[model samples]
Structures are given as C-alpha cells and as structure tokens.
Target: MKVADNLAQIQENIRQSCSNVGRSETDINIIGVTKYVTINRAKEALGAGVKNLGENRMEGFLKKYDEIGNDATWHFIGSLQSRKVKEIIANVDYIHSLDRKSLAKEINKRADRPISCFVQVNVSGEESKHGLSKEEVPSFIEKMANYPNVKVVGLMTMAPFLDDEAILRGIFRELRQLRDQIQAENWDYAPCDYLSMGMSNDYQIAVEEGATHIRIGSELVGPYDE
Candidate 1:
C-alpha cells in the first residue's frame, strides 16, 4: 500500500484513540520512522503529509537530511554517541535519546542553538534499552540545567514488545505521569510537556494514556528494505 493510504488509516486510528480519552488528535505528532526505507520512500512520506521524520542512525539520518533538507522536521530517535553529536547536531531538529550526561554535554557543546530533547527513560527496566532508569530521571534532568544548549521538551521510552495491552498501557501511563510530574515544576530548561512513547505496535494504547509524540515505523513506512 502507499504511504498516503497507510497514513490515512493511522490518522483515523489516532482520531479514535484521542476521542476515547477526551484528548485532541491534533496534539499527537506522527513521526515517520524512515531509517529502514530508501530516500525516495522517505520523500514519499513527505509527499503524504508526514512533516516529521525520525532516523535512528547517524549515517542514515545524514543521508536523508541531505536529500530532504528542511522539507521535514528531523528526529534522532536512537542512542546517540557523544562523538557523533557534532556531525548531526545542527541538522536535527529534535533529539529523542538524550539519556546520558556525556551525550548531553556533547550536544550542548556542538549545537549552535538550544536543542529540543526528550530524556529517554528505561521505564520497563529492560537491560537492553538505552535510557536512564525511572528513579534516575529527576536528578538527571536536574543536572541538565548545566547543559544550556539542551532543552528537555519531553520524556521517551520503549515498552517491552509484548502482546499484553495492560502492560503496554502501564508503561505509557507511567511515562505520562512522569512527564506531568516534571512539567509541573516548570523548569525553564525542562518543561517536559511531551510524552514521546508509543510506536507502530502499540500507539493507540500510548495515545489513550497521553502520548504527544508517537514514532511509527513499519506500520506507516513499512519495514527495513535496505
């Protein structure tokens, strides 16, 4: 199926999800995860009205950014290495994996402007995930004040890939609550207004629980083809 068609379906699902929780679908930003597809397919996503595109790897992100330019809002949605920050910092509009002090320091040093970042949290306690543990998020965010160039716009997490809807909703809900707790503080550097949880497999659940940004990959742009 075409990207447009897939997008329309996803939009409808988002509408329903929002309606279920008395929230507005307009608040949800759909990030077309284009890391796996070709640049042309990424363009196809842009043609379909997906203005935000997400890439997990620096090389892939640089490639897509070269072709797409400012045509789309770019999101770096994977673990970022401190050394690679200088290479991609200027080009990316949002960094979704701001998990460590070293990476944050690099972004602060490399970026010419304050960067919008989501402090990645390993809410599910999965050893494989790259994020701060839930207990460590607050202090970590607090320390972020020193990194003047990085702004904590939200919190991000990847739930365990499972069929249990209850567990999925729990993880998403926790992230929302955590975001709210932080947002309430009204830190100039960490407003923490967005919840960057959810993905192709469980975005509807994420939406119902208060996800402002959902990263859809295979369901929206298809699986890895490179």
Candidate 2:
C-alpha cells in the first residue's frame, strides 16, 4: 500500500484507540518515523498530512531536513552521541533520548533555544536499552533544573518487542506512571506532560496508557524504496 493509505489507516487506529479510553484522538501526536525511507517517501508522509517526522541518525536527519526543509517538525529518536550534540542541537525540535547528565549539559551549551527533551527511561530494565533506570528518573529530572536550555517536556521508553500484550502494556504503564509522578513535582523546567512511548507495533496500548506522542515507522512509512 502507499504511504497515504498507510497513514490514513494508522490515524484511524489512533482514533479508535483513543475512543476506547474515552480520550480525544487529538491528544495523540503520530510522529512518522522516516529513518530508513528515502526523501521522496518521506514527502509522501508529508503529503498525507503527517507533519511530525523522526530520524534515528544525525546524517539521515540532516539530509531529510535539507530536502524537506521546515515542512515538518523533526524529532531525534535514537541514542544521541554527546559529541554530535552541537551538530543537531539547533535543528531538531524535540530530542527523544536525553539519557545522561553529560548529554544534557552539552545540549544546554549547544542549543540556540531551550530544546524540548524527553528523558529516556529503560522501564523494562532491558540491558540493551540506553536509558536510566526507573529509580534514577526522578533524580534525573530534578537535576534538569540546572540545565535551563533543556526543557523536559516528557519521558520516553521502548518496550521489548514482545507478542504478549500484558507484558508490553506493563512497560508502557510503568512509563506513564513515572511521568505522572514526575509531573506532580511541578518542576519549572520539566513539565513532564508528554509520554513518548510506543511505536508501529504497540501504539494503541501506549495511547490507552496516556501516551501523547507515538513514533510510527514501518506501519506508517513502510520500508525504504530507494
């Protein structure tokens, strides 16, 4: 199927998921993950009314940003290297993997303005994931008070690719709970309002659990054509 068709279907799914929980579909933001697709395919997503685009690597993001210009809101959704912070700091609107104090410091120094950041948490306790532990999230958000240039807009996590809905939902639920706990603190720089959990396979569960941003890849853009 074409990108437009895929996007339409995904949007419907999002709407239905929101309705299931008595939530407005507008509460969710579908970020089309265009990391592996070509510029033309990414444009197809834009033509389909998807204004948010995400890339996992710096090079690909820069290339797409050049080709797509300001037509979309860009999200850096991968493990960002501290050394590369200066290169992308001024470009993207959201950084979805702020996992360390060093990276936060670098972002503060490089960002032209306060960058909306999601403090990544490895809620599933996956050794392979690159984020702080659940126990570390509160302290980490507290530390963000010093990094004025980095605005903590939310929290992000990647659930293990599992078929069991119970397990996947647990991980997402944990992230949402953690987000709520942090938001209660009412930290000035960190609103902790958004939950950047879920992807192509598990966005519905994420939305039901209060996810404000869902990063969709293959289910929305499909595989790269060129």
Candidate 3:
C-alpha cells in the first residue's frame, strides 16, 4: 500500500478508537515505528505527512536520522543499554526504554540537554521484558531527582501479546492507573502526561483507554527487520 494510503487508514482507525471512548483524535500522537524500514521509507512517511518517527536501535537510527531531516521527531523505542545511552542521549528526542536508576544516571551523566524521557514499567511481570516492576518504580522515580536533564514525561510499557482482548486492556489499564497514582501522590518527582503504549497490533484499544503516544510498528510502515 502507498504510504499516504496507509497513514490515512491508521489515522481513521485512531479517530474511530478515540471517538469510541469520547476522546478526540487530536489528543493521540501516531509515531511511525521504523526499525527495519530504510531511510527512504521514513522519507515516504514524511512525504505522506507523518511528522513523528520511532526507531528502536540507536545504531540504525544514527545512520538514518540525517537523511530523514532534522524536522522529523525521532524516538528510541527499543531496549537501550547503559553502554549506548550517551550516543543516543543527544540525538533521539525521547528514550522510551528507560527502566532503571543506573540507566537514568548514565543517560543523565551526559544529558546536559533536556529530553523527553519515560520510565519503562513492567506492569505484566514478564521476565522477558526490560522494564522495572511497579514496586521498583518509586525508588527509581526518587533516584530521578539526581538527573536534571531527564524529564519524566510519563511511563511506558511493552504489552504482552495475548489472545484475549480483556487481558490486553487489563495491562494497559494497569499502566494508566499506575501513572495516575504516581502523579497524584508524588507531584514533586512524578510527571504524568504521556502514556507510551500500544503498537501496530493494539494501538486502537490503547487510545480508547488513554495512550497519548502510541508506537505503531507494522501497520504504520510495515515489518521492521533487525
């Protein structure tokens, strides 16, 4: 499908989902997840009117960012290691996989420049994932005080793929509630605004619940290779 046509379809779906829950489509931001897709595809997306683009790997993004233009917003939506945080800190607009204090400090050590960052919370207790559990976030949030450069925009998570829609909603709902609680109790350190969840498979449902930023893979720009 043409990039424009695909973008239109996703936008229509976003509007329908938002309307379903009495939310405006304007509130939701669609980030084109371009992991494996080439820089040409990113250009196509921009040509098609996609202003936001997401890449998981810093290595790949570095090579592609200059070509994609300085206007396109770039987000690091994959598992980021402490070793590579410095290089990505200055470039990517947002780092969505921030899961720990150690990583935060590492990102902060060089984060002299302020950036939009999210604390990755593992709402599902899945060992395979990279985020900290809800119980661990408080201390992490506390630790965030040391980082003057990292802005705690909100929380993010990678939902477990399940056959049950209820199961999926439950995970997203939990993330929303947790974010609410943090903001309510810890206004000093917690900043709750962006809920970075959902992807190609589940973004529609996510928007219906309360996802301000959805990292759309697959359906947005098609499959991403390593």
- Candidate 2: tens digits of C-alpha lDDT, residues 4-97: 8898898889889888999999989999999888999999999989999999999999999998888999999999999999888778999999
Question: For model 2, what is the alpha-carbon lDDT of residue 28?
Answer: 90
Instruction: Name the regions of candidate 2 deviating beyond 4 angstroms.
Output: none
Structural similarity to truth (TM-score) of each candidate:
0.98, 0.98, 0.95
User: Candidate 2's C-alpha lDDT?
Assistant: 0.93
lDDT of 1 at 157: 96
TM-score for candidate 1, residues paired by index: 0.98
lDDT of 3 by residue, 1-226 (tens): 7678888999999989988989988888889988778888788888899888998887788888877647798888888888898887777888888887777778878777867888899988899998999888867777777787778888998888876788889899999998887787665545767899998889888888799999877887778432
Model 2 error, position 224 (Å) = 2.0
lDDT of 1 by residue, 40-139 (tens): 9999999999999999999999999999999999999999999999999989999999999999999999999999999999999998999999889999
Candidate 3 lDDT (Cα, whole model)? 0.83
- Residue 143, model 3: lDDT of 73
Question: Which 10 consecutive residues of model 1 have the lowest summed lDDT?
Answer: 217-226
